[model samples]
Target: MKHRTPRGFKRIPAWMFHSRLPVDAETRLITSYLLTSGSANHPTVSELSDALCMDAKTVRRNVYKLEELGLLKVIRRAK
Candidate 1:
């Protein structure tokens, strides 16, 4: 299946790479992975990292950025 890049994520700026806005590449990547992980109803860092081929540490760090910008909810991690 051909995968289309999600909307609102085209031509993101290098300075905004860490922004929570959908236009940011890292943000878009993490968010996109979460959106497709069947975890939108209960998003988790590990699942998103697995889907994105990123490390948990990076996922955790970026998740913090997303949460700080009010783009994502960061509930406590599951045991």
Candidate 2:
């Protein structure tokens, strides 16, 4: 049987890689991973750390930096 890829896989625009935005290597990698994850759900710091093979604290720090740069936004949902 032929294997099938999952749906909702999106391609990161080439411009993002070569844009004027001052994004670092780590931030860009994390952003790309999130974009291709196929969901609007946000991943936790632990998840990001595990996926990126970086320390949780490091992931949290980078996430904050991304937020500061307006490259990533956090939306709160009521439970």
Candidate 3:
């Protein structure tokens, strides 16, 4: 299991800070959080909202944007 804490040191790619992608600040923030914070494929939206201090709806929207760019895949867990 990934050893995650409420806050901890995370390795982030330098490219993220200097990428040429036409992503907004929020998209970049979401990408950074996922790269450093989320599970391999299970970054919770609630966790993202709490950490980033943004609304869940906003989080979902940015996530969708990231998905559309083909940066990551969203695998919904079975209910």
Candidate 4:
């Protein structure tokens, strides 16, 4: 599935920046990294893990949190 940016926003996957709840520096840092270094060229989790020194699974989980907050969308593949 293609993850297109929502209307009136950069394609940058930055949900933490404009979150309703306050986000910590670590989350903001990760969001910034994703916005700059990430591209459709690679998986978001992979890029985030490398930049934040976190496991890809952890990145996936946090991104889901962003999705749940209506800040972004998560695309799922057919099993």
Candidate 5:
């Protein structure tokens, strides 16, 4: 039987896992979550922390690491 993916689920690219970039487990988890989160409703640091069951500081630190590695980008909206 063919397996069907759940509706509204984001599909991670295979290249992301096979890339030469060095991504730690936490970074990978964060990246995947971010990728799956819809553009209109991206979770905040606190939300991610709660979802991942990690400290907010830890989540922030990993987010920065992912940014440094070019896996994530921060865009500021004008107030």
Candidate 6:
């Protein structure tokens, strides 16, 4: 399946690659991954962990980071 890159992000800034904090880098990577996931997949934390080759903790942390930055919204569903 082909995915479309989101508008306004046609080019990722080079500075994202040189961020000083490790979390900043991971957050940017997660953002990139999420942008690539496109408008279809709403992956769970475990799934994101698997795709990104990171642990669940790392995935969750970066997800929250993205949320804080207003780049992504995390919806909680009641079980």
**Number of the top candidate by lDDT?**
5
Tens digit per residue, CA lDDT, model 1, 14-47: 4433443554456667755554444356567776
Best by TM-score: 2
Better of 1 and 6 by TM-score: 6
Per-candidate TM vs. native? 0.54, 0.62, 0.61, 0.47, 0.61, 0.59
RMSD of 5: 5.6
Q: Rank the candidates by lDDT, best first.
A: 5, 3, 2, 6, 1, 4
lDDT of 3 by residue, 1-79 (tens): 9733335534434554456666776776776667665454566889889988999999999888777766654222210
**What lDDT tens digits, residue by residue, belong to model 5 across residues 19-53?**
67776677767766676665634578999998778
What C-alpha root-mean-square deviation, in Å, does candidate 1 show against the real structure? 8.0
Per-candidate clashes come to: 0, 0, 0, 0, 0, 0
How well is each residue in 26-66 modelled by candidate 6, as lDDT tens digits? 67666666656655357899988997789999899888776
Candidate RMSDs in Å, in order, are 8.0, 7.1, 7.8, 9.7, 5.6, 8.5
The model with the greater TM-score, 1 or 2, is 2
lDDT of each: 0.59, 0.65, 0.65, 0.53, 0.66, 0.62
How much does candidate 3 score in TM-score? 0.61
Q: What's the ranking of the predictions by TM-score, best on top? A: 2, 5, 3, 6, 1, 4
**What tens digits encode model 2's per-residue C-alpha lDDT throughout 1-79?**
9633335434445554457666676776677667766553689998888877989888888788777765564222210
Q: Clashes in model 1: which pairs?
A: none
Residue 52's lDDT within candidate 3 is 89
- Whichever of 2 and 4 has more lDDT, that candidate is 2
Model 1 stretches astray by more than 4 angstroms: 1-23, 73-79
